[model samples]
Target: MDNNNQTLATNELATLPLGHNWYQKVASNFEIIQSYLNKLDTDEPEANNLKNKFDNMSDKLNIYETNIQAIVNILSDYDVPIAIVDGKVVEIKEGD
Candidate 1:
């Protein structure tokens, strides 16, 4: 998408009322980001500067994905209602 059409989570993701759905969306984004980062790890030199950037970004992303997975686990454990709108989490009805 063009820069103007990009999904700005700080705006749309935050203002919306999605719950577990957001977790799934975030998980998807994290996957895409991780894949690119992995490619960079192999394609680029192992110099300290490049390594540091990849390490920091990848580590933080892993933490974020872990958190998202935790929410997914919770929702699954309870069989909560889940609605993913436009590939993003838009609703989650608990215990339903």
Candidate 2:
């Protein structure tokens, strides 16, 4: 049983998904948002509020993406299944 499990893990590792360039696309989008925010009048009542909100959201996104990348890196180094479905990790058994 242990040998079979090891073989199954090896096969699954061989099928790991390739990395996507989604980070580049997301960075480009953030640049566009920053440009729009820069065009706003600094003295406007809502300008500061909008800028603060945008900054907060940008920080959160950075943290989220960084964490996700780290998780992927660690997972790729092990025998765990990298399959994620609907925000849940899917584990495969020997016969499944």
Candidate 3:
């Protein structure tokens, strides 16, 4: 888009009311910023480094989510109540 159109779109986005769906608004804004960054010259070394960092962060997030799910599954296997204390998962005993 031309500079005029880009400015108009940005102005419209700025005018949006941040209320109940504020998270969706912020996510869309991030998408717009990512699109702009993706349009940059890929041959630039700094851009490559930034892309790598983003990739690494994405991978780490995935790993963290997977581990959390695994912990949830393991905890769900037992019928007793469990609690996390001092970074450890312990089963709750009756009348304790």
Candidate 4:
């Protein structure tokens, strides 16, 4: 490839965040919760109440996931290198 293309690719790579495991873990937990909720038989009164609670929880989780993704996208657009450091989102500098 030409030097220009190489530089562009490098810049893009530099902007990309280093960590995704945190997001993946959150997504996995959401999946697990949904899976368990799906297995419940909501015909019984107690089960129905529990199902309603789970449904609400699922909705909140979905909203949270959406917001997280939006933030990630915004950061990516601005070429910010974000990562989970000490249980917080931190910027990673080049060569650090």
Question: Against the hidden true structure, what lDDT does model 3 obtain?
Answer: 0.65
Q: Whole-model lDDT for model 2 versus the true structure?
A: 0.61
lDDT of 1 by residue, 1-96 (tens): 123333434445676565547776666566666666777687766677778999999999989877766776687677666544464554575554
lDDT per model vs. reference: 0.65, 0.61, 0.65, 0.63
The model with the greater lDDT, 2 or 4, is 4
Q: Which residue pairs show collisions in model 3? A: none
TM-score, predicted candidate 1 vs. hidden true structure: 0.35
Which is the better candidate, 3 or 4, if ranked by TM-score? 4
**lDDT score, candidate 2, position 71:** 85
Winner on lDDT (3 vs 4): 3
Q: Mind giving the per-residue lDDT tens digits that candidate 4 earns over 19-91?
A: 7345554555566665556555444688778899999999999898778767866996888787545645678
On TM-score, who's better, 1 or 2? 2
For candidate 3, the C-alpha RMSD (Å) to the true structure equals 14.4
TM-score for each model: 0.35, 0.39, 0.40, 0.42
Task: Give each model's clash number.
Answer: 1, 0, 0, 0
> Which residue runs of candidate 1 sit more than 4 Å off their true CA positions?
1-47, 83-96
lDDT of 3 at 32: 68
RMSD of each: 24.2, 27.9, 14.4, 27.9
